[model samples]
Target: MSRVADVKDEARSRLRWFAVHGVVRFFAERGIKIGDPQAKLIADPVTRANPGVVYQEIRDRGKIVKGRVAYLTVDHGLIFDLLRSDDYRTVVVGGNLPKPLRAIERRTRTAALHPLAPPSLLSVEPPSHTRYRKLVSSVFTARAVNAMRDNVQQVADTLLDELVAAGGGTVDIVSSYCAKLPVAVIGDILGVPEADRDKVLEFGELAAPSLDVGLTWSQFREVEQGLEGFDGWLATHIAGLRDNPGDDLMSQLIAASEDGVYLNDRELRATAGLVLAAGFETTVNLLGSGINLLMNNPDQLARLQDDPSLWGTAVDEMLRLESPVQMTARVAKGSVTLEGMDLEAGDLVVCVLAAGNRDPQVFDDADTFDVGRSNANKHLSFSGGRHYCLGAALARAESEVGLRTLFDRFPHLSSAGTGIKRDTRVLHGFRTLPVALGEPATVSA
Candidate 1:
């Protein structure tokens, strides 16, 4: 059997184990308890013989319940009736976002700090947290984002120009394009220095697999040191902006603070950091998964090429199917009831956005990719309620521009046989994807 088949076989077997065990009832069976936060997970199994599986552990009532976040190659969703169970309570959403965002929540819970990081950004107070989101929405208005079309086009065009000049023989599209373009655009918007762009992108990949499951103290310390470096870098950048104003978002935010109608220095830095992470990293996964999807389904690719506007709408569908932000965490401030489980305050919950995006009941043909479908936005890829992504428009704009330019230039583009599967540590994406440039076109570099 092929290697891909082996991976698929393993996944199928794991899923089968969950089928007989019952989705929500497998955590205790797996022997995971207070050593970690308490939550229930319905995950993708290694085989089809079983349908549900226990992959994540729960320790306390404060944690949230996000069953399983799936991959595009997987069945795409896992569901459980936690709400209908006798045990239901509010718990922390124990994904990477909460832990990271919790460290500093002034202005960044809405932004992605790392592409693979998930332990931060949990909201203890949904109402206030939702309101905080509204304030950001006011800034990332449709008008503000629509204004970025020229910006997106500039970044996309410049990068492709460089790509074409490098002689277009065989390029690692992710390294050459997908991974860098969004970061370039967002970093510039936030005024991040040119010298640091590559390193920042690398940091986003550090936690692709989620928090250290069995890290020694030293390993965890290394991770913290890495985060400290990132934070320190941002602090210096903000200080520079404070000293000399520019036309970038950082300067604009500084001016807003002077007007007494905006974020403070700390808040400004957090917001800027959020913008960098959101604008670049999540889209990395989107573009990677998207290209793979297209290559896997040429029919879909042809359909998209026949109508480029479909790229905009299709982007949403892609986000749903292969959600880049995979999971988000939320912590409960006080004790609450859910799924009949009596829970206490400070419980952790890891809401699997990717899994929810593929819920069978929520989508028609949930496992299949159908860009023509009208229900794409129903996906929790951007999540729902208060914490919707502030950069959703910007992310879409980056993709629309990038994909459109790509198809326009290299309609015959295709992947090389294999790639560097983006290290599966913090994020699930491609760090390298070699593709054929195929037959130069009349397109201008």
Candidate 2:
């Protein structure tokens, strides 16, 4: 923690980052020059924002298109199979690098508990994955989520009330409502104090890009700082919970044990941190994308207005049309044949979930966004199998109630400007969504 130690740690982190991603950037840039669609997908911001063309190109190439770095798949069925299969494992940072680079990574591994690191459900496979998942699964079960619905609605209503009180000018919905609502819910669930909710949001924003690949040194440093800060704060918070438990999920997790084996300090921190951050990040994207989609497609909005029951399906449709988490990768555990394509051990497969959601074979008129689309719920947006999003139910509940309440309150909301998109390939959503709240709907007397 001294200045000297800090400098050393920073140097080590930089070395590890370069070992893992610097070569990736170098090849990605070279591949981009050669017009490699996969490289462009990895390196280009424009391609990340509008990936359909590259997805189509990948699909056209084959079921599994080899890229400069890894193989790409946009096929819905193959993605589904790969996600569910035990033959594939989650890709851990520094895991697939060459021996020398991995040696550099091992020596320089930082002490920060990253959301994508082991002990976090995102990074581990079964046995460990099963254990970690089991401890938290009960809290997110359908019954538990349904019990939280009224609270979610109240939170949505409170946020909308604050938005209404901001006069009638343009405001960034991402900050005011979309981001705040889910963060508040997740914060309360994690026993995060109201005063520190903003700090949690700040940490989340800084660390969001940790899910991505090929980050520049500055980006990597920022992400590590965020992770380090969150780790320190979470340790103190967990100690407080241990001393005096509350009704929050984190408190429940603190006391909960499995077969007389309780979670250690590191495991506890990783689980609590992942839940708190992942709890709201994607939902924030889902809400932002939902609002944008509704504004752009008035017919879909009109349909929802006519039949409020369609709100549930409307959220699913939004997730399908504009998936919050764009892509996820899996490394083949061993020799495997997927859809007649051979994959050896450690072969990386980047599943384009957004593209798979738009696969024509899976959904008729896949590009179209229809709230009433009967098969909207079948999309790969939540992913599949064990690594599927733990907060999917809560996200759905929050998005359904949040979007419904927003539009119901401001029935004539309109865009103020083009707005800013979050600059990350893995997570897709608005960073700032400026919208004009036309007028408050008349409430029943």
Candidate 3:
């Protein structure tokens, strides 16, 4: 590209960064008021700025209230009941969105790909949800996760190896470390070949925005294109697995489906997309958020640097403090009363997963970031009941290994520049995190 083109591209990037920063700053200062009793999360800035306060306000009003969609917040007991209750159904796959929005999604062609692009597991209710969930549960069991510890450690080391070698005196942890590790591990788990890593990584990002219900038409077009690429590759890959079976999860899925008791070809492909995308997206946020929290809190960073044993609990604390998935949607399966609020069948209910994690009734000093907190393990970073994150064990292993190995290597790591926040509401984390390793120590003469 010519210098003129390069300059234009750079200019655009700066403008976008400033625009996002401005909106964030605006919400942070002015604060948001949900005058509409039935609030809907229509934009990213409000939730991104301070969802905790918003949730608290909603929760204070009663157990549930009207909005664009009804919201359940702050009350862990109510939220848990809703999450685990068969009375509620998933928003998208369960056919809960308003007719106009659902029609719009279908017209965009993006909705058609939802089952496979995000997979049915995260969005569908039982019978189908149960079958899909059971198919992959064995692969992520406690014993299975324990077995991957060595591989997780090795991947962490390799990524950190690249970071220290190329970082000189600084690195962007999001791109250089946190983002790369989870994708690589997912690739390994799914049996993605080394030669296809670049394509897998590229498609992973393009396909991710489809998971959010707040996407615009243009965003839907982009997501459609991404799903086309991902689904095409997945279909062909499943075909290959059939021709030549392997020990990976993909092959297992294929064999299970052949019995006619599990998912068919399309469902199998959808399940694969869901696992890979879900695995990569959430785990990346957990690592990035954890590291960012530690950097901002030197005392906490020092504690971890002093003793690596605390790394496990520290990851939990991070999940509690900065949940990756902020809220999830559920629709009333049938008319029912929650916290004394009556709802008709098909009413939408949004569960504030992160807010519940910080509920004062369940957690002591709920607003404080304390890594040593005894009950950090009780966080709802992973949803509860039937839809609980199937990959919880694997995520914990990957994050614990990644964060532990990182701080151990760069004890002097500190922020070198401003970090940019992602422009999404449902998932939150940095787009980039610049840090300096304090110029590697000079050896004494």
Candidate 4:
């Protein structure tokens, strides 16, 4: 009887996965065939790889262009306003979906917690979001991030040292340096054991595509499995932290209380898991993209070498050129008119943040990479308003220190081969950055 029940459960799980993701994929592919910009942007890999063209196409259409599925916007000012507007919400609810799809989604909902699902910071509204954000905001503040600079520097130096010891002919910098630096720092903050850090990275990589709109069965399966493993591991880790806590951020979170009401077990897992995964994923992309940008623009690299003070602005420039997070979505709370376009309740608006970062109206010479661009900081790479990236300071610090230390150590570092971009749509970054780590600079006597 137990064996039969196990088989029945597996069948139901597969059916739910199909109903939730496969159905969406089927329609998205049809939309792509018809040249729907929004559909292509979401479902087509080629379009995702070269999204600048589509971003411009949407911009040319209008500030608020209606798509077959959702409305699209690439205007910096408009996107900025919408993100901060109370008229919009993060998660898509019943109002946005067809009756059939909504019923399927409701039935398919499982116990698994998704980063983009409710209870996660990315999906909650004001009150819950306010409470969750407050709990973790202090640790990521400018002052707190500044305190972690020394530790970041130490991690960068150690990684470079290992590269030198390897005799330095060629190495995939993404795996060796760019990815490791931020992960080490975040791991220390989150109390993840060093031996298990690689597992965390694996789970994060597999689950990353969950942020996208549609997925194939295989992709959806991999993502669900990854989330399951992470959920189990996190539950155990939290239990251990409760038994014997440390000074890490995870420990602090465990001890934290709001109005004498601590977070419940499910809420704790959701919050902690988000911190652990988000802590390093985007920073890894920032570092990888920063390195690639500097390598491509030797003139800009020379400027950084001449004046080290420019590293800060240089990091901002990199963000402007290649934002780690490319886009986000919001749902209309009720009937509203924006830029003369009427949006009903539950309408979805896709904000191409990468395009907004490069809006000519807001940025001069937007396509060109300029390290000293005065208004580089104005870019919406970290997003805006209440949902802005909590770890912006840490990502910036890591990118600046990581890039400066790398170039300073290996002044002649050059690409060994063409870098491979990540196979993700929402998160833009390199999967493998192969580089020849030239001889290190000798210290003065």
Q: Rank the candidates by TM-score, best first.
A: 2, 4, 3, 1
Query: RMSD in angstroms, candidate 1?
Result: 11.0
Cand. 1 TM to true fold:
0.72
Error of model 1, residue 184, in angstroms: 1.2
The candidate that wins on lDDT is 2
Per-model clash counts, in order, read 83, 0, 6, 0
What is every candidate's alpha-carbon RMSD to the true fold? 11.0, 1.4, 7.0, 1.7
lDDT of 1 by residue, 1-445 (tens): 6999878744543332223222333442242343222222222223111112322222122223433321111112321332122232223322322343334332223232332232222222334344444455555679878887898888887887787788887888888889888888888777778898887876655433323232333343344445556667777888898898787766766665322555555555556666676677778878887887887788888888888768877888888887876555444446766445444555544555665666665688777988776888777676444445678888888887888787677778887878666433224467678898776567743
Q: Mind sharing the TM-score for model 4?
A: 0.96
Task: List pairs with backbone clashes in candidate 3.
Answer: 37-66, 38-66, 38-67, 38-68, 39-67, 116-270
lDDT of 3 by residue, 1-445 (tens): 6999878745543433223232333343332263542233444355457666567777778767666445555567778887788888776541554465445334433233564223478767777787778777755567866877888888988777666677557778888888888888888778888787778777766666655554554554466567778888888888888899888777777676423686778788878888887888889888888888888999988887777778889889999888888778777878898777788998878777788888888899998888888999988888888989888888888999988878777777888888887766667677788888664433234
State model 3's lDDT: 0.72
Residue 393's lDDT in candidate 4: 86
Output the lDDT of residue 304, model 4.
Answer: 91
Stretches of candidate 2 exceeding 4 Å from the true structure:
1-3
The lDDT, on a scale of 0 to 1, for candidate 4 is 0.85
What is candidate 2's lDDT per residue for 1-445, written digit by digit as tens? 6999979977888788889778777788888888787789878777876788899989888878888668899999989888999888998888888899989988988798977779888999989999989988855567877888898998998888777776867899999999999998888788899999898888889989988878888888888889989999999999999999999888888888889888899999999998888888889999999999999999989999999999999999999998999999999999988767788999999999999999999899999989999999988988899998889989999999999989899999999988798988889899999999899997565
- Model 3: per-residue Cα lDDT at residue 349: 81
> How big is the positional error of residue 13 in model 1, measured in Å on the Cα after superposition?
37
In model 3, what lDDT does residue 247 have?
Answer: 81
Q: Can you tell me which runs of candidate 4 are displaced by over 4 Å?
A: 1-6, 92-95, 443-445
Q: Name model 3 segments beyond 4 Å from true.
A: 1-34, 37-40, 44-47, 100-112, 115-119, 257-260, 439-445
